[model samples]
Target: MKNYFLEISFLLFLLTFSSLKAQTYARNGMVVSDNKLASDAGVQILKRGGNAIDATVATAFALAVTHPAAGNIGGGGFLVYLPENGQATTIDFREKAPLASSPTMFLDENGKLVPGSNHDSIKAIGVPGTVAGMFLAHKKYGKLPWSDLLSPAIQLAKTGFPLTWALYNEGNYHYTNNSTEFLKNYFIKDDGSMTSFGEVWKQPELAKTLEWIAKKGQDGFYKGKIASQIDAFMKANGGLITTQDLAKYQAVERAPIHGTFNGYDIYSMPPPSSGGVTMTAMLNFIEQANAEEIPFNSTAYTHLMIEAMRRGYADRAEYLGDPDFNLEMPLNLLTSKDHAIARFKNFDKNKASVSDSTSFGHPYDGENTTHFSVVDREGNAVSVTYTLEQSYGSGLGDPELGFIFNNEMGDFNAVPGETKSNGQIGTDPNLIAPEKRMLSSMNPTIVAKDGQPVLVMGSPGGRTIINTVFQAVLNTILYDMPVDESIEAMKIHHQWLPDVTYYERNKMSPDTVRALEAMGHEMIPVGQLGRLMGIQFFPKDGVYFGASDSSSPDGAAVGY
Candidate 1:
């Protein structure tokens, strides 16, 4: 295994790369997040002798309060935990469709989609699983008391934290420009204006909600008064969630999806999330084709990467979904190296492959999510990525509950059997079903060398998540890039249906763009890709280093 400790020594290394950007370094534990306060809170948990699992549970809850745009208890996601002395495992907390939901729920009388019903309305919310997921992680692996892990978030919500310019800017823009009345109510002051930057923004109701969980654990939110209130609110607002759905919601602890990438063990959340298998397949394609020999930023290299992404995404739409719902899913085949090589038989190396249809069963997630990575002194690592489906979720919040509801129901294939060229997937495996967890692209992952977890990584960009994470692993382990560069490196995404390869604007040379376009690939540009949080550990001295995404204005990598 390569020792990054020697590769980027300026901050966390004993050697130096060429003018590498600054990175946060530490001798023992580290926490990385897009929210500084959330990172600090996780580091505090580490300082208090908590394990990586404890710190991550704390960090996720803290983000729920501090970064409402994505961090959420009103939403759900996946968590991967790697212990120094124990087996690696994952918690699948991807949200479930309400019991009343159906394959045709989003369709109108004419069988067309009910306009805005999938995301813009009350029916979009799923039975939330964040609280249950965190609870189970703590119950099985947490070192600190469950209540202690929640204290930081509770305090931040109750006592208030200074609103950052990013939040203020984004929130105010929506508040003013959005036509929805509910959108205008977010982050409002008593005078009916949007909260300003640098002002203390408090959510006392959210604090109370946290207090309930702290006192009674997951039941605090999924049952009793909170569940009753949610049911009542749903009834009043024409939402689909019921108290039964809340009571029946259970965050499952499933075996980690395991793959070998160039001798490193890649462990991640399994089905219900297409991330791990898809990413591993992409890695397999790259390794099988020996594409690493090509220059990293050249058009040829980008073409190969985009083809791999297209195939992986294409297979995802056809073969993957909630494992419990699709018992026949070819999990082993999809993640195998052989399957990857089989996929590349059509690769021309010089051309971009068509992405209209996948090789398997059929065809086709959100870009609004948050991820954080935690590493404790004992060598334990935790990677978590969660989301509410969109910015401000459903654009609906309860003053009484003090949290936005996730529109995650939209994640399920809403229009069955109607795959579209515009990126709308209607694959059967992902069609909405009662009590089924929607398929996700949230791939929180850990890379272990010689059975020791060395890297904990994940990102949030909906469908872009899998590609970003796939590259992060390949960047660090295969290309041997420094931790910061692994995260900040220019990235591209190509989910199958859209048939458009998106490159981060200004990051790609115009010549490179034209060169890629010459390969029959339709290329577009986006302002950014996924916002990643990552950590690399060097066991020689038990040192830990963190790299937060540069895209987040308030993000940081905190360590001690």
Candidate 2:
């Protein structure tokens, strides 16, 4: 048994090292994404006379088949697009609460929260928007046929693809605990064994679904046989969705939040996604603090950035939410230079701010998600982030559909306005309502210089996503590092709740950690922080640089 364990350990090490050996480089057109197969699919689109938007559509569909844990059609996400000569815009396809859903749906007879009921059940599923989102984007900016864009993914799903060791291990780790019966049925064989690495994995059902959608577009998924399957499943399992809910779902077109930091113009998803507002606020605070004066990754710089992030998160919890539901968000105040200066003035360089001491207006507040970036030679760029909310969300995937649904319903505050056992407010701007979209932290962003895109980036770590993207932007603009080093740098996150600061283990030096501790931070070390996908373009030189987080084994930055 000891020798067997040793052999497995050695093989895993070799696999990790081999994956790491693939390095970052520059190219003319590129796609950087969490899954290598998805990146290849996007590159193939670019090679076949497709533009950036076309490539992004292809990549997203391919990810649905290759990285099923997070990439999903049953889930929803945000997309930020920048055309060479056109204005930037965002597509909001975030999952919405069913019309029948109420604020108290997750509560019990006692009006108290029922812990696991919100996450691991059929009722947790929200009406998905990925198909609508993809179709709309393609309609507006796609240079290739919709059928052509989906062909790669359909082929990969129908024909078998080799399972990597990382995927095999992740499947076993997530499913073998008997946490979800459906997940076990999908990954585990009847012979009492789990699927092994290098096995040929096929999803013919998913292929058929994609083919139907390819022919009929969004209507195919939302109003046809696919919708019937979802409705049937919900009816049999005490779920809230109806055929009406699926048919009523529409992808919204929102104006991207615009900001300027260090001579670069930034565009990201607007409200309903607090990420853009919060991240922009942090950048404003950092710029106000003259953060460029400090050495990159130094203890002083880290301390300052952490403080800014702390305040940004606080603001997010207190004020940001779905604009349609809560129309009174402090948009002008939160993103203003004056507000940022005022917020930074409260920070004490030598000490961390206590959670209780923070005030409102004054203020405010992880699982499975994926991000991808693409850039075409025409200078069009796309940065997108999507998710299932958690690994195998709801664990209630339709076996016939060959896709997993999102437990985004769990994202809502079940007991709004109530104080938690941990001493934090339950909800305000993000309270649940019928058919309202939950607040999300997925920030797909693009940075431009005088109307020319310079950086396209985003990440997946639930709440930690905003901070990861914030730090990476700082590394590139303030520290003058390439995209690779910017993504690979150590990260620290403070969400202004529970009063605990979490830092990635070994990413920070011991002395830096000790200094932060001395400053009154209740620091906790974590193994990893986020998985970011980014591409940096130099319009003057016509060069493109791609970066994928090394922490994710399947991630790759492919270019041509």
Candidate 3:
């Protein structure tokens, strides 16, 4: 009788586990982002019959309220949108250098790059494009009312949201870090103490700004009172942006870069985002190498990947930049399979590729960034990576407006041909210039299998964004891991100039690190390479599975 009872209990446990696993399916819609409130806001839009674009707009705005460190309204980013029945496209609202900026803006009198000068000053601010970008995207594809999409964020700001441990940590860091300014203004109390976790944090001023935008549309922020306020602020703070710059800002719509890898089509943002071109080059190089024979995450496979990354980044430094400025960017040749093969031919699998030694054919010549993905019931999808370039960006807050502006100026080549501390040579194509967009690594990507959207993914880690997306795609396609497991897996990054292979601390075994080092690779164990968010679709099963990287402690993947 005891044995019979034990068998029945075991059977019940198995059934319960199976039922829980089956619940991963989402036939209606999915929203995966690095913040729970933001994901819930997007999901709310989907529940209200909003399309993917609407949900994305809603999510982006909500992120500004919930994840202020990177998700921002004062910054700029790129987006890739896939309609239910049309070709995928990208929107480039990347921040442009101020009209008053010059090529040597960040250089000192001695012609040396000033340490932290570009990042910690008001001059670091660019002519912001987040408002313009979202407005244009919504005007083109959003299904819900524009005001409706922004209401959630406005309401949250007016009322308040509980501070999560992640936010609390950010506030604590600002209190201690002398470089931080705006964060203290918003998160610190009158008594000079930081807001603790779970405390209600409100942004009445930000709410006012959102309310103005909701009522007046694009002109509300870009042309009227807001623009005048920004101009005044800039003049007072030594920033170069003017009311004319704000009024003239426009988000450009561009074709998404489409490439094929392992029988799957990958769609990503194009320049002034270097992400698409870089990711395409890496994928093509891997394809040319016949990398399928190697096991995923093994030492051999990791080495091959590092070499591929090195080659891609080398090409990036030499060729890529703002297409509007550098008309000679070799987009076709860069993305061509033939070019990839030619580039990979010189790679030696036995040893590390020296950054300065390899000579490539003359061709072209390309921070903190945030990403989120949304897929609605009608099969429409949107993947966006936006940012203010650093944690709390520029550290210069708009006191009256209550938000921080991006320090994207830090991304440009302060001086052409300057060698950075990391040993990478700055290229002329990306040199600072008036009205030129700074180069970016924000890659918002989508994967479709057999003409059906299967994966919507992207990440935030500046240069690490490309490789993180590459590994995640391979995780789902090659390893066939579940979406959650795939995002949870360890990630490693190598930018040719850095010459150091950074592996996620505690994720790679000591044996793997030793093996990589034995191959003449400099192995540096780092914490949390990138915070990725993804939604994987199983067409046959009529379900969607979403995953948020555990590194983002408060991230959420909501579906219905």
> After superposing candidate 2, which stretches have Cα over 4 Å from the reference?
1-21, 24-26, 188-193, 357-365, 419-425
RMSD of each: 5.5, 4.1, 4.2
Please report, in order, the local distance difference test score of every candidate based on alpha carbons. Answer: 0.87, 0.84, 0.84
In model 1, what are the clashing residue pairs, if there are any? 9-13, 9-15, 317-363, 317-364, 318-362, 366-462, 367-461, 367-462
Per-residue alpha-carbon lDDT of model 1 for 151-195, expressed as tens digits? Answer: 999999999988999989877888888545655776787788788
Per-residue alpha-carbon lDDT of candidate 2 for residues 419-479, written as tens digits (9 for 90 to 100): 4424234566766787888888888999999898989989999878888898888788777
Candidate 2 clash pair list: 314-364, 315-364
TM-score against truth, every candidate: 0.94, 0.94, 0.93
**Model 3 alpha-carbon drift over 4 Å, by segment:** 1-24, 176-181, 189-193, 357-367
Task: Give the candidate order by descending TM-score.
Answer: 1, 2, 3
Score candidate 2 by TM-score against the native.
0.94
* Model 2 lDDT on a 0 to 1 scale: 0.84
